[model samples]
Structures are given as C-alpha cells and as structure tokens.
Target: MNLNTFIQKKINKQLIFPFIILAIVSGIFFMSIGFRTTITTSKIELEKAVEKWNNTFTNMENFLEFLSYDNNLIDNTEKLGEILKNFYNKFQNKISYIYFSTSSKNILIYPETDMINGINPNTRPWFINASKNKEKTQITEPYVDHITKDIIITISKYVNGMNISGVIGIDINPSFLNDILSNKDLLLISKNNIILFSENKNKIGKTFNIPTKSERFISKNILLITKEAKGNVYIVTYKNLFLELLPYYFISLVSIFLILFLGKIVNKNINTELKNSIAMPLETLVNEAKNYLNNQTFDSSKITSNIKEIEVLINEIADMISIIEANFQELKATNEELLDAYNEIEKYSGELESTYELFIEKMSNIVEGFDENTGNHIKRVQILSEFLAKKLGLPKTLVRQIYLYSPLHDIGKIKVPPEILTKPGPLSEKEWKIMKNHTIWGAEILDGDPRLEIAKKIALYHHEKYNGKGYPFGLKGELIPIEAQIVNIVDVYDALRSKRPYKKALSHEKAMEIILKGDNRTSPNDFNPKILEIFKKYEEEIKILWDNLNDNK
Candidate 1:
C-alpha cells in the first residue's frame, strides 16, 4: 500500500509476469490443437461418406450390367418384376422402390401403388435418358423424389433383347449414407443447394444457403466442411467454433489459474529465503559496523546468515577492524619515537647549515683580499642574487643554494697574485691573463663538493660571456650553467656599482643604463637575455638591495 511495500513487491511482480506469458502461450497452443482436431476429424468423416456414396453409385451400375446379361430375366416383364421384387426386399433400407420398365408402357413398381398408373415407361426420365445411350446406362443426379419427398437417384440400363426391347431402371433412396459416422453429424446436399440427406431429419428438405465460391466455407453461422459425391456435396457443419473448443478453453482457464497460484507461492518463498539468507544479515552488518565505528564495540557473531559469502564478508570486516585497531596502538608509539628522532635531526641540520654559511662568508672575505669595501661588495651581490632568484620563481631549495653560494663566485681570486687584486691601475696584458685564471682556480677550489656544486659552476663559468668571448673556456650563451649566468650578471652589476680601485662606483641608474645599453667595457650581449630581462624588470628592487646593503649600512 505504501512506497516501501510497493517497492518490496516489485521483484515479485517482475517474476510473476512470465507466468502470465506462459499461460497465454499454453492457451494458444491448446486452442490450436482443438481447432485442428475438430476440423480435421470432421473433414475425414465427410471424405469417408463421399467415398461410400461414389461406391454406391458404382455398385448400382454394375448390378444393372449383370442383369442385362440375362436376356430372358429382363425381356419378360413378369419375370423382371419377380427379379426386381427380390432386390427390393434385400435393399429395402436404401431402396424405396424397385421397378423394371420397357418401352411398351408396361411398368411394374414393387409395392405397387395407384401412382404407377401415371408413371409411363416410354416417357419416364430413366427410360427417355437411357434408351438412346444404349451402351452406357445413364444415372440421374441426386434429387428429391416429388411424391415421397426422399432424396433419390435413378439408374437405368437399355436392354435390346429379342423379346424385350426397353430400359431396366432402379430408383434408389441414398439417405442411408448418413450412417457412416456415428458421432459426427453429416448431410448429403444436392448440387442445387438442397439438403438431400441429414441426420437432423428437419434439415433434409431445407435449401442449403451455400456461399458463392467455396466447397468448404462458413455459411449461415456454420463452418461447412464438404466433399463432392456423385454431383452432390457431403457436408459436416460446425455451428459454433467456441462451443466446439469448449473443452480446451476450460482446460486453458484451469491451467492459467494454476500458473497464477504457483507464481504467488514462488514469490512468497523467494521473499522468505531472501529475508533469512541475506536481508537480516545485511541489516546486522550495518548495525554492527555503526556500533564499531561509533563506540569501539564489535560483535560479529550478531550477524547471522545461511549464505557462506555473507558470513565470510562479515568475518573479513571484523578481522580488518581488529587489525587496524591493534596497528593503531603500535602506530601511536612508533610515531612518537619518529617525532623525537626528527627533532634531533632537524636541530643538527640547522647547526650544519649555519656552519656552511660561515665557511662561505669566510671564503668570500678572503677572496676580497681583506678589503672592507670589496667585502661589502660581495655581501651585496649575495643579497641581490637572493632577491632576484625569488622574483624569478625559482624553487626554495634552488633559491637558498643561489643565495648561499653566490658570494663564492670570486673565491678563485684567492689564487690570484695580490698585485692584480688591488692594482689601482690597468693591468698589463700578462697580469690580465693571470687575472682570468681566477675563474679556473675558483672552479678547482670549489670542485668535487656537491654542496657547493652551484658555487663551482659560478666560479668556473661566471666570466664566460653570452657571446662566448669573455671566458677561460669560451663557453657560449646557454652552454654556461644557469646559476653561473645568474652570478655573472650579479658580479657585473656590483663591480659597476662598487667604488673599485680603477673607478668610482656608478649610480644605480648609470649602472642600469650601462648594462642595458653597453658601455665600452661591458655589453648587453655578454649576459643571458632571460636574466637581463629580470634585472631590467626589477631594477627598482635591485636598487633597494644595493642601498640597504651598501658599505655605509
């Protein structure tokens, strides 16, 4: 009645519809059998009667031929009458009367009636028809006898004897043909649509309203099955098709009722089985799972089922919860120990990182030849590189590496002679050659230490120009390491801005102009185009770094 009940019965409805189909199919199957059985049986009975009717006509003709051989038997009217009387006694059932007539107005009809006075042999239908056709006896088609109103056919033989020269005729009543089938009703109908013979005597004299173009057809609410018999039709009529198949119809209705009954019982059994085997256990599984998740209480034994897979699933869920609970306690202790160990490692990492920074700054200070101004100069380069690296969106680890290792770009100056370090004048060509060796020496000093790998590249390739001309190795453009290229631009900027021994520190604007548009000493072509763009875009940020970290600060 409600939604849940309707939905629960949904499967029952789906399962029950097939029984409706089965009932319909069985009904059609039995109905077809009934129709074919009734119609086929009726047709077979009609055919048998047809054969009997043909045989009767043939027997009559044969009898007439045998009688013609006995010339004396047929030549004398007195003897012929005696002979016909004997045949009349023998076949009195099918023969209403037997007669022998000649051309001389002499006629003898057995059980002679006063009607015989009106019957003339010379002008009778039998004599007039058979006398001219002498060899073949002419048998008239089945018709109603006018006097007796019985269905009859007349057969006549022309006998040309020395004494008797006339026709011998017999009048037959063929109503006995209806006795062929005891159960099936049959009719002998004349070609003129007259009912000649019928089991129902009332129908014997009626006109059969035959359909226009069919031997077997439905007529006047009757299914007519007919066979041609001696120019007449042997008919079997079924008045009502439903009444004929009533037995099968009753059986089909009973079968459909039984199917519906069986379907109801099956659906009930299915629901009961599902409730016991699956539904109740699934409900328990949900309830138990909720209790376990909410409160730490689990009792898998409460989930009961007859099905093996359901039992196994419940057991697996219980087992998994048990394992997770046990592992949780162990995991709590393990995580505590790992946290303590992590704190110790991070503490050591901070101290080690600070040591590396102190070591790098000491190295940069040594490379400046203990000069305060140059010391501040390298420190400013570190700040600028860190700021620019962050603006470039470099990863934090890479930015930290660039910030820490950038000041070590001139660490190779440690190997340079002190005269060129603070020459206060232009270097000789030989001293300039010695000056370029600082990049190679710086690479050698920071080499083979992975922690300072970027430092090594900056030292070795920082002097390499984007055009590949300002280097010990002449490494070109992108052939220089990106960290080295970054340091190269930073080194030039600081060198132009710092109060160097050869020149006064240029203003930030003057230095930016010289870097973007070349001075005689420096060219825009010597720097990586990407790093150059960043320097131009963030020139204001670079100016802030220079002012904040200057020697005065």
Candidate 2:
C-alpha cells in the first residue's frame, strides 16, 4: 500500500483505541486532581487569612496602649486635647480624630469638642462589639467610614479597666494590608476555586489557565498539602507555588509511551506486508490451476501483471492442468466401455426375475385347471389374502410378500403321483396321510435360496392350523406366524370354492360361515378366528375378486 493508505489503516486500527483510552483516563485524572487541589488551596488560604486578621488586631491593640498610658498624655479632657493636637501636627494629613465617652449616657464627652476632637461613639459597630464581649481592645470588620469614604478597620479599648471607658479608634486604609499580601504572591480564590482576585487584579475572577505541561503543578500541591496537615489546624509554607515543574516531567513520560506504542504498530505492519508478498504468488498460481482443470480458458497476457513470480507460477499450473484434461478424455472413453458391460448384466438379471414370474403363473393355471369348477383358484386366493391382510391392518410388506408367494402353495403337488392328484373318489386314510406331506415337500423345494427365504416361509406354513391341528408339524396358536395364519384362511376359502374331483365348490356364504363358526378361537382350530372375521366383512369384495380371476383365466 501507499504511505497514506498504510498510515490511514494504522490510525484506524491502532490510534482510535488508545486515543479514546487516553481521553477518558486523562479527563478523570485531571478532574480528580482539580477538585482536590481547589479544596486544599482554599483551606490554606482561609487559614492564612484568619491568622493575618488576628495578628493585625493585636498590633493595633498595642498601639492603643501607648496613647492611653505610655505617653502619659490623654488622662482626662485637657490632656486628651493636647495629645490630639500634637498627634495632628506629627502625623500631618493622614491623622483624623480621637474620642472619649461615658459608660452609658452620651451627655458628657471627653475634651468636650464637636467636629475636630471627641464626638458621639454610640452609633459605631465597634462600640457595640467591645461592650458585649468586654474586650480590652478590639477591631471590627472592614467597613466604609462616613467621612473618609474609605474601607478601614476600627480598634477600641475599655476605659478605667471597667464598663465606662472612652474609645480610642483609628481607621487603617485597606490598601496597606492589600499591598503587604500581594508581595507574598498569595492567590485569592473564590469558593469554587476559580481565581477570584490575584496579585494581578486585571485577571480577577477568571479561570486559572495552566498549560497542559503545567497541569501536574496543581496535582502535586494537593498531595503535598494533604500530607502535611497534622490535625484540623496546620501550616505549610508556599509548597503549591513551587510545584510547577511536575507537568513538564509528565509530558516527557507521555512522549516515551507514544514512541514505543507507534514503533510496535509500524513493525507489525511491515512484517505483515513482507509475509503477504511471499505468499500471494503461490495463491494466484493455485487459483489459475483450479480454473484450467475445470476446462476454463483464459488469456496468458491477462496473467502478466507486475508480479513476475506469480505470472510464471500461473503459467506452469495452467500447463499442468491442460495435461490433466487430456488424460481425462482417455479416462472418459474407458468409463463408457465399462458402463455398456454393466447395462448388459442388468438386462439379464431382469429377464431372470420375469422368467420366475412366468413359471409361477403357468403352474398356477395348471393347478387351478385340475379343479375345473373354480377357475384360477390360486390367483383368487392371492387377491383375497391381500384384501383381508389389508383390512386387518397387517404391515404392507408382509401382505405383499404373502400375496406374491401364495400361488406356490400347490407347487409340491408336482411330486404327487397323477393318479392320487386326480382321484375321483375320497382319499383313503393312508393316501390322505401321504397327501399331507406335500406341505413338507413344498418347504423342501424352497429351502436354501437366500432371496426367496421370506416367501418360502409363507409357502411351507400356509397349511398350518392356528389350533395346531391342520399341519405336518401341528404348530399351535402364535407359534404359527401371522403370515401363515393369513394364507391358511385364504387357502381354505379357495379350496371350498373350487370344484374338486372329490367335492363340489361351496357358495361364498357357506364357505364364510364355515371359516367364522364356533370354537375357531380354541386350540386345533383350522384357521384364525380374527382373520376369518376380517374375511367375512369383505365377503362381497372377495367374491368379486374370485369371479374376476375366473373370468381372466
């Protein structure tokens, strides 16, 4: 990437997080320090202010004692007049007045003077405070003098060491104290910690502006001040004003952190670019190879970019894929040859199944023809068995299996001597016993064939009676499989309806009555009673199926 793009990406990824983090951390840090600094500085300033005011009042008290006693001048009215006149001459224009008053009534005044010397002291704020607190001497809070029109502090003392004393007060200008405090470089702040008035009053009440590099000055002051306090009252020298170097040190530390963070980011970008430069050529070649193997064509000229290594790799991969394509054409021809051979085998397999079906159909016709009264009797039995099995809700696989295999029920009769099979009279007990062995013969012929194992099971067991009476094995109820029971009912129904050489075919109603009659639920029963009931319910449909088989055959 170009330098600008690379730098932009770096800024987006690296700078945004750190910048936001710095802003949040710095904002919280600054606010916490600012709050603590303001509290500490304001507390210190208030303490100093109270101490200054107290000391100033002490100084003014000592001055009042000199005029009251040490000079031995102002004892009564005449001496006070001499003292006031002398004070005016020595102090020149700066000196103002002196006062002497009674403890209660203001009728008598010291020096008995009006405008120039003593006057009424009852209306003064200091008079009220001195009288209440019984102060030896006290100074009131600054207020404007009525005559001078200037802010001053008033001092007073009790006369005669008792309640009735005259007042000696002087007005000290506000600028005298202001000038002394300014030389100490004290910053007078408001309740909110904004600079209210400072030595430079031009910027009074303005917010304190410290450079970003100078912010640590305030932060350190708060820490130092908090450490020095012993109890509620303590004093520290001007430690905060000397704290201005801290911000410069902080700026140096931040510069180091910035350089290290940016260096790591730039190194990571350079390493990633070198790695991509090495890997992209191989990736492009792999893509080109895949496209060619899929039989897609592209111009060689299009692959010629500024990257020669990738171009050469792509060209080689394309050639290799073209070789694979040619090999695939040969493989396709061989696959076609094998496909034709497989189709031929599939045709022969289909013919074998068809031949098996045809043999069963021809044999079924021959067996039914032997009893000419009920034509196609085996086919009718197959249809009736399916219908009854469906009505009984037997699983469909078992039903269709029984239907397809039921025609082979008489396949064992092929082994029976023709004279016995076509006999006009009833079989003797010995011959009937021989005849019952046909079910065994049928099972024997179907055994050992894997594909027809299920069909063989039905064929071998169809003659079995549910009551264990009508079979070679005499299998009992539930021992006889359900498929066997179903085939047994349809087998008997078909035999009853067919005209055999030995007996006439019975009507459908007569056959259903025999199949569904009493004691069919007991052991040795010829067929299942439940299956017989299903057969009876569909007797009309069963008759139609039987008639259709006869007509078709």
Candidate 3:
C-alpha cells in the first residue's frame, strides 16, 4: 500500500473507538437521568415519614417523663381524661388513644373504649418494660388492644413519683399511620411483610411476600428501601427499578443514532455540539461517581445538574446522613418497687401532710411547663399572696394557708385544652369562655382537701372582678373571697410583667401602671381597693422582687 492509503486506514481505526466510546457515554448519561427521579421521590417520601415518626417518638417520650414526675394523677384520674383530650387534640389525628395507669387503676383508654376484664395495664409487658427502664420510653409489638379489639402499636413510659406509680403511653392506629405514608408504593410492615399499613387497601393487615434482595432483575424490577422502627416494624417502600430507565434508554438510542450519523461527517460544528453537550458532562458524571465510591463524605453540590440521573446519584450518596432512630437515656423502678410504692401510698393515706407539700412544689413546675411564659409564677404568687394577706391583718393561720395553697391555684388548667393554653394570639369569644372554665376546673381539683379550702376558693373565684366583670362566677367586690382577691391582684401583676405568647413583657413600671391606673384589658376596678392600695404602696419593692427572681437567671 502507498503512504496515503496507510494514513486513511489509520484514520478509520481511530474513528471506530471514538464511535464505541460515544455510544457508552450516551448510555450512561440517559441511564443516570432515568433512575434519579425514582430514587429521589422515594427517598424524600421515606425521609418525611421517618422524620414524623421520630418527632412523635421524642415528643411522647418527653411527655411521658413529665407524666412520670406528675404525682397528682396517682389519686385523681378524673382530670386525666381532660388532660389526654387536650394532648390528643394537639397531636393532630396521629394519636388514636392516650391513657395512663397507676398500680391501683387499670388503663383508661381515651375516645370510645369498652371495659375489658382480665387486662391490667400495669401487669402488661409494655408497662413492665417501661417500669424497668423507668426513665426511658419503650415500644410494644403490634397487638390487639383489649378495649377496642383492634391491632395497635404502643409506646409507653413508667411513672413512679412521690404520689404516683404507674405507666403512661399512647396507642397508634395502623390505619392512621398508613394514611401518613400516603404514597401507594409505601408499606409499613412488621416481620416478614406482615403489613401494618399498606398502599393497597386490600394488602393492609395481610401478608405480602417481598422477593429476595439478591434476585432483583428486569423480570422482577422491584427496589426495596427499608428503615427499622421499634418493635420489629419496618418502614418499607417498593419502587420500580426499571420504569424510567426505558424512557432514558430511548433517549440514549436517539442520541446514539445521532452520534453515529455525525461520526461519518466529523465536521467542526458537530464535534463542538457532541463535546459540550454529551462528552464533557458524561465524563464529569463518571468522575463524580468514582469520587463517591472512594469518598466517605458526599457533597451533593458536585452533582451539578437538575438531570434526574444526577438527582438519583446524589440521593444514593445522601445515604450517609441517613435518618437514625434515637434511643432514650434514663432509668425506671422495678415491679417490686412499683408494687411497694403503690401499697405505701394507700397505707400512708392519713399521713399526707408532707406529700401535699411535695405536690404543691411539683404543681408549680407542671404549671410552668404547661405555659412557658409563667416564669416563677407560682413562687411569685405565693410571695405576693403572703405579703398581701399579712398586709390585710389576717390571722397567722390564714396567712400560712394562703402561701401553702397559692401554687395550686392554676391546677385546673389540666382540664383546659392545650390549643387554648398555648395560643399565640387572642382567643375567640368561644375560646375565652373555654379558657375561663379553668378556674372551675382548678377549684374542683383542689376540692376534697379541707386544707386546700383557701386554694379552692382562690381557684374558683380569683377571677371574679371587684367591678363584677370577671369570669366563672363574676361575683363583684367582697363576694370574691379575700384569699382569691389576694391572688387575683398578684396573678394580674405577674401576668402583665411576664412575656406571653400574645404579648410582650411589660417593664416593671409598665406592669404596675397597668395594674393601678388600668388598661383596656385590665382595670383598677378589677382589684379590691385595699389590695390595690398595697400594690400602690409596695410598687418599688415588688419591682425589685420581680427583677431578683429572673427566670433566665
């Protein structure tokens, strides 16, 4: 052959490999785009569901801790239904039932529940496990609820405080949980594909076999994504691995056909289009993929494009920051200790002078927890009530009672709905009416205790205005008891001073001004003239007291 013929043969050989490489690059680019959408969609859905579940878990655990410390529920379950109703309302419709049980009482399920014999919540495995862990929350395997006769999942925590010893928890309805993972592909299953909640209505509460992990092929194009919840339950989603890939494959075929046609001409414009549009992007994707396999940390920024394939690759890389189920750190009482504490509470019923004192302390904390803006409110109320009672020349015994029971004044809030209690804005007329009933609830809570007579009166009639415009009874002037009158002025003063969800914190001068001179919301006429004079007399000292008991400090 001549020199020209040999050069042409060399050129043809080089063209062959370039065509092959172009085919491969085109396939990869479209392939990545195809799978990315499927992966990203599934991942986002799973992440949201997992995040929701985890949040509920954490909140429930914290609430249980609060319950464990609340000893009042030990003897009084009358208000528990109210408390549960408020809590249930706040959690949307996610919670099916909210209940608690002391060693003395069997579990009381909220909503409609049937009385079931031979079922003691305290003796159950969930309660026992939580009691053992005491401080930590525990989850139970899906089981038939004795009251409802439906399969339900439970999360429980043990309660062992000064007056109470028991378990508190919530039951999650599988159907409600299913509604959260609304996508048809999602299935929350318990052990071996026993569907607790399923995308397909017919598949719910039934067994559906998930094909073997290692056997995923075109004929069985299912992709399984799994995250474990407590109690052998799994959040699972089945996505089609091959669905979008075909469309991407078709795009690749078109691109490949174009590349082949362009290869024959090998013109400048075609080369420019091919290099910029296809070759460089594909090369970058390959480099990113390589780095991902080698690198432990993924920077999604490198994915660099909105292409579905890039998204899919980015999501797969995003797996490093996976949602991890958090476990609690705490302790609980033994069965023997629980039993002994229960027995002792009844055994020492007549000797509750000290326990009552303990309850007062906890009630203050509970009140503050219920309303974050309260800030040493019960403490301040006690001080101001005592100071005013002394100023009134009341007997020492009456003064002592005022200080002791003042903290329990707002104890009736347990019956108020949490939505109203924590409202960030002004209540509607109806809500205001509901809010006013807390006084009645408070009185009822403090009832049955002779020592709490002053507290009960304070709770029931504290809001009765000196001008006759206040709530729950609206008894004007001396019709409102002196004990209530004492707390009323103090409650108003402290409320104006504290930062609430709806209002800014007033300066000490502003608070005193609002109380003495009156505002649209408050009236000097609301205060007894004698109590109003005491506030006017000790305004500076009261300011000092408020500044000294800074909650932040």
Give the deviation of candidate 3 from the true structure as CA RMSD.
Answer: 37.0
Q: What are the models' TM-scores?
A: 0.45, 0.38, 0.37
Best-fitting candidate, scored by TM-score: 1
Mind giving the per-residue lDDT tens digits that candidate 3 earns over 1-553?
6433444455557775698688879888888877777677777887787677667677777877777666776446677667777888887477777877766566566664557445676666566667777757777655666766666667888766465577777887666676667788777776666676665656666775764232222237877677766445677767777664677878988988888777767644545554554445455656665665577444556545545674675576466335311211112335667789889987798468668877787876786577556677888888878888888899999998898888878887888888888988888999988888889998888789786788899889888899999888778888888999899888898888877777888898888888878888898999899888988888787777777766533
Off by over 4 Å in 2: 1-322, 327-352, 366-374, 392-397, 518-525
Q: Residue by residue across 1-553, what tens digits does model 1's lDDT show?
A: 6333554588577988898899888888888898788788777776777677677667777877888788877667777788778877877766677667667765678767666665566766667778878888676545555457666657778876667677777776644654543434676665667665566666766777765226567644466676666533444444467677899999888888888889888888877777777777887888888898899898887888888999899989877986887789899999999999999999999999899899888888777763335638778878888887887788999899988988888888877778677788888999999989988998899888787798888888888899888788999977988788888888899888888666787899999999999988899999988889999999998898788888454
Among all windows of 10 consecutive residues in model 2, the one with the lowest summed lDDT is: 226-235
Runs of candidate 1 exceeding 4 Å displacement: 1-10, 65-75, 101-106, 118-169, 181-184, 205-223, 231-240, 279-305, 308-553
lDDT, candidate 2, equals 0.59
Local lDDT at 267 for model 1: 83
Off by over 4 Å in 3: 1-17, 36-38, 102-107, 115-125, 128-132, 146-150, 161-164, 184-240, 257-553
- Tens digits of per-residue lDDT for model 2, 1-553: 7444555566556655665566456655655565556556645664665466445545556656665553334445566656655654543333244454544433222223444334346666656646665546655544555555554545565444222255666544345445424333444332233442344555444554432112233444432221111111122223343344356346545654675566557656765664455344444455555665575854455444456676676677657765775788898999998899899999999999789877877776775554334566777777877788788898988776777777777767767776677778988988888788777887788889876665676767888887777677889788887877887877777777777766787888777666666434332257677876677678898888887887796
Best by lDDT: 1
Return the clash pairs for model 3, or none: 32-309, 33-309, 36-312, 133-332, 134-332, 135-331
